[model samples]
Target chain A: MSFDVNQLFDVNQLFAEICEEDNLFAFEGTITSEEINTILENVEARMAELQIDLKHRKKIYNITVECIQNLYHHSDMVPEPLVEKLGKNYGQFVLRRPGNGYFITVGNFVLNEKIKFLSEKIDKLNSLSSDELKEMYKFILNYQKLSSKGGGGLGLIDIVRKSEHKLMYRFYPYNDDYCFYRLDIVI
Target chain B: MDTLSIEGTAKTPTVRFDASKGLIELKGRSIPENSIEFYKPLVEWLESYAKEAKSQSTVNIQLEYFNTSSSKCILDIFKRLEAIHKNGSEVAINWFYDEDDEDMLEAGQDYESIIRVPFRMMEVAAG
Candidate 1:
């Protein structure tokens, strides 16, 4: 059997690239519920280690929970043809402290058809003033039946309200029918 | 209707609903991935209790945190309770939020406005 030195170099390069943007933590792969548990605990522990105030720590934790679980509900597994090329079911989840507040970035594979709905959702949410967002949140809370995903867009609203900022989003075409949806929540 | 008590875990909340005593208490964090599974029974219990209630019920919610899915289920419970209240049964919901947690307080207020089941927001010492 021939040893592949270049493959090792390629793997190391990938690790370095992931580490470049997020020195704190970066995860890319299947995010089972069990994985979410461990990731949350580790994040909590890290925040404690950093001596972050409880309130700030919890805000970070809550936003992270919503972002990752958004994966469980929204992200489709990479189709078989794309698995070899894509590496995982979802895109990378990076938590980093670039300057002041923490940056949480999560990406996943979403059907191209969903782009309009998602983009419009964010656009409408962004258009609202803080007061309007609260009213809209309550209005949706009162009327909307829980979607099959078990939430009626409350995750997005919560993310916006907690961060108190517009969501930064990007859709990179993954293939003919799917696109990689990346969301950035800063807090 | 009987009392329903479910112990809490890192991911789920503790529920204490005693029909006999007219006391309903939900404390601890509720972030269960399948909130539907965790909250369905409680909602059903409230539905059943609403059928044969003879006294005032007090619901005490002192949650540190809960996720979006749990929010829907929580509202379901509140709506059921509102039905009970509308049927001439006295119902009071005391929403307890940590003094420092405005998000939780706002959540309780949002529920209060929508449920019509008179909510009292109380600031409690952080636990």
Candidate 2:
């Protein structure tokens, strides 16, 4: 099966649906650290308008930071077949309000071979109880060495733990050699 | 030794470590893309301070939030402070969070359990 957006996906329809979701912000294509910072500032300013308490505001903000950072850490160049349509390391992230809480959804490219490993990883994290999650977080914090990207593979753990909710995700085949890894966190 | 202070930014935290006064503080959000780079000086300062730290050193951490990358750097800071505590100086880590921020309190508890230094979780009234 192929995952070519030009034929298999409708970019305009997807973008239009995203627009109707009460989006606070959405960024497509290349995302850098500086760009992430700018988006964080924009989200913070928008959340401030809600006049909610500070604690919740900080949670949503922090989760948003982690979500966007995923782009920098996990984004892969689109497969050659899809490169012209998707560009290199191009991803889509949206912060929106669909229900009582905010939703942070991000979709980034990953090499197709990585899908199984990532799938099991997220599933393992999702299956743990809250206490187990805490233990895993500590174990990782103390024992696991930092990766080249400066993460101990704990971002998802921290995100899931903070939101105290499930880490919802999906994997869409973007091409023969790439997959679209989509993650959604509600806070 | 002189005091060390760095202003906070949208991506990094503010640090105030007064060597003579035995007071160390880190406040604000820490989500820098390269937290190791941002926090290298603070860690190095603490390493030097541990050599001749005062008899009683109080470290205050009032982070609104920090990313996972910053979490490791924060742990590094505590581990260095642990050296100071083990070296015979009385060290107290005061972790402050908004009254309603249970997650922040839990974060403090996690660090307290991990590090040997004394940790005081101070809850400020929510605004």
* lDDT over C-alpha atoms for residue A51 of model 2: 76
Clash pairs for candidate 1: none
- Top candidate on DockQ is 2
Q: Please give, for residues A74-170, the per-residue lDDT of candidate 2 as tens digits.
A: 7766667666876666778788887778788888777778878877888898899999999999989988877768777888999989888888877
Model 1: DockQ vs. true structure:
0.65
State the fraction of real interface contacts model 1 keeps.
0.56
CA lDDT, every model vs. true structure: 0.80, 0.82
Q: Second chain only: TM-score per model?
A: 0.96, 0.97
Supply fnat for every model shown: 0.56, 0.58
TM-score of each: 0.89, 0.93
lDDT of 1: 0.80
TM-score of 2: 0.93
In candidate 2, which residue pairs clash?
A: none
